[model samples]
Target chain A: MSLASRELPSVAATMAPPRSPADTPAGAISGPSWLNNLRAMLAKELLLEWRNLSRLGSVALFGAVTLVLFSFVAPPQAGARRMATAGFLVLALLLSSTLSLSESFRKETHHRALTGLLLVPVAPSAIFIAKAFANFFQLVLLAPVLIPVALVLFSVDLTATSGVSYPLLQLLAVWALASAGLAAPGTLYAAMTSDLRGRDVVLPLLFFPLVVPVLLAAVKATALVLSGDAMGQLGSWNLLLLIFAVVHGTLGTVLFGYAVEES
Target chain B: MRGKFQWEHAVLLLALVLLTVGTYIGLAVAPPERHMGDVQRIMYVHVPTAWIAMLSLTVAFVAAIGSLWSGKHKWDAAVVGSTETGVVLTGLLLSQGMIWARATWGVWWDWDVRLTTSLVMFILFAGVLALRASVDSAERRASWSAVAIIVAYADVPLVYFCVRWWRSLHQVQSTPETVDAAMMLPLRINAFGMLFLATWFIVRRARLELAQRQVEETTLPERRSVEEVQHA
Candidate 1:
């Protein structure tokens, strides 16, 4: 057989060349699954926050320090002490919320990973809801740390009042409602302002003003609950919170899409 | 020549003249409250300021939706201009509110839900304007501020509802469902008047800024941007 014929003899036996398209992964694990994607995004955000150990530490420390500072400003009387306690807790919530606003989405933006997160199929509102939940979690953890100091220093009445539930429940509700108020707009604005030069300064400028309604409602509601004032007023405060939640929640849901697009 | 000054400019000047007269009328022509005398003069500024703030936000909300859908720079300009004006008017209203509260409530400030929420609305827009100012890229600034406009617009109802939901020192004066004829006339007049003034101001500012930006872009050397584009 000639050299060319010898080389060609295997043509009948050999397989055709594999096409590039066929070789490509047919069912390869490209990215996370639906549930896993959401969880991973949320978990990644939380982990990034945790790694910044100093931010949370400062927030917790500030709440405690502020509680102690406000205690000194409180008078010895029962009503005054209660008022001071309520004021201090509300202020603590505001400060933490402010901190949350400034730092809420910093990790994602800093890592330049937000674009990747956005590429995921998860909804934008979920990101907002998850961030808000994270903020609420931080506040919940910080509250207990500050509560004992608040009680000890300010003599806040933590004992169950006649009509009001345990002081803890009332305070918790206040924090949750206020947290939602602060976080909704805070997250939205942070997302919007993340690309700005001075994001820290920009964040609070947008945050504190929009939080006025929630702060007022929270302060009054917390004050009423703490004072064991007319139970009727508590009902009103709840209604106020419901309004804020609905308005801001709807707003967040609607605008978050645009924000994510802008981001 | 683009008619040197457009009809809109003339209309704006006329509106300003009318607004000055309205201020005088509200402060001097209107009867003083029997209980809350001379200091009631503050209402002229307070009422007008509040009216303008809400009007500005309404414009912003419309402009936001417009820009988001149309992608026209004019709508974005409207959003920026109105938001800036809204924030300024809200701030003025807040300061006026503080003065009113000091006179009536015997305190300079109170944690009233309505007042606080209004302040929040002011801050929301302030942040918005800051967000707009801080960015050099027009597209990013417009798109981002548009997001802010929608977010802030959503808070309007929350601010409005705050007065009614919580026991607040600030009273809920007017609502579509609840307005009385006695208060409605002046309130309607003031509301419409303020709307006109806000639109006028927004258009005027937007035109000037847009023109300035156009001039700046045209004047920049082409080679610099072309080189930057190539490097990118």
Candidate 2:
């Protein structure tokens, strides 16, 4: 047997027992019960974030600062200014999401928690799915504050036939969909780079290019919502976003097992 | 070893001959276009470079799948070789495209579908190479890069479709029907020349990767023992 496989039992012995009975097989958890492991992992991630609100706060602060700075730098012209604001909003979210993803993976590396997780009998894909969901949640949490600030600063006309509530709901949908699209590849790339030094530099270089489609669709959709597209052009962009989310999410889950096993 | 050297030399000689003839045909034999005159000649190089760029990446994608399926060092070498070649060709394609655009479109750059998709492809593969460089272990690097290439390749069609649907200022994509028969000759010649050159480069680079891996294996035998002991 390979050294890694030989060492697995000892590592498993050192790790805590599975929290749920379903996760623990009669003897040694032979094959992971994916759904149960996913639930347990996702809970652990959420609980960890709840315990440490500072990290989420910092990410939100960074996004807010970016939006404010963008609003100032953008030309005060009416038409161009609104379009630029949509672009910048996507940019800010992209940057903040990159930071949060790297940080989330960094936490595991910092506390050596990854080793413990790796030791668990659950499939590595479970860890990936859980981390992706957690990152998506964190990005969603930023929407309430970030969206309002963006709308106000960019002078987005929300008083359409349906009023502010409709646009707000549209924007939130964009955020959630974009967040899923971003987080899948973001979490996977974070795990890939977690062991490397200078991962801060490496992650964005790897990430931004891969996620360009997501950024483009999100920005376009957001612009349409801001301008109030009456012709239903937004549907195509939303479809693109959905395709991006599904493609990356599925790819990340399937590939994460291979990526995380590297160390 | 002797056979390999003979094939390499033969391929090199053939590539040189084809390239010289292709350049002559492209620059001299082919009549200038009605719209742009001699500046349109750049298409001979630009189109082939773009074609080969996509071709090389397609090769890399296949090699990535091969590496994942067979877990062979040779497949990883093929991945590296084709990917690196794709990057160089992509860079060439971009510059030639800019030159062609400046003469024809009156702008050095346009956010057109093809240009945007090609740029994204270049960045994506370049990131794969960068990722390959950062990792320490051969096995890890190979496997991770294989996975990366597959993921990046998945985006190729998506990027193409997205950009195409979003905006297109560039000409409608050229096909045999659009290209003049006389103009098609040089384009075909240059394309074959490029294909031969790309093949030689990929073969040579793959061999180099294999040789380097061999040397690394011999020189770093102790690292394995150390890892084994650590795991133990």
For residues B1-232, write the lDDT of model 2, one tens digit per residue. 5444447657777877888898899898989887667887888888888899899999999999899778899999999999999999998888887877776778899787888888999999999899988877898888889988998999888888877766644567432345688898888888888988999899889989999899989988798889668655
Per-residue CA lDDT of model 1 for A124-173, tens digit only, reads 66566666667666666676776677777866566745567776787677
Q: Which DockQ values do the candidates obtain, in the order shown?
A: 0.57, 0.65
- In candidate 1, the residue pairs with backbone N, CA or C atoms under 3 Å apart (3 or more residues apart, or in different chains) clash, namely A209-B120, A210-B120
Error of 2 at A254 (Å): 1.1
Q: What value does the interface RMSD of model 1 take?
A: 2.3
Clashes of each: 2, 0
Off by over 4 Å in 2: A1-32, A160-165, B1-6, B168-177, B222-232
- Candidate of highest DockQ: 2
How far residue A158's Cα lies from its native spot in candidate 1, in Å, is: 1.3
Per-prediction TM-score, please? 0.77, 0.90
lDDT of each: 0.67, 0.81
For residues A46-115, write the lDDT of model 2, one tens digit per residue.
Answer: 7666765777888899999999999989998977887787799888899899878887777676435566
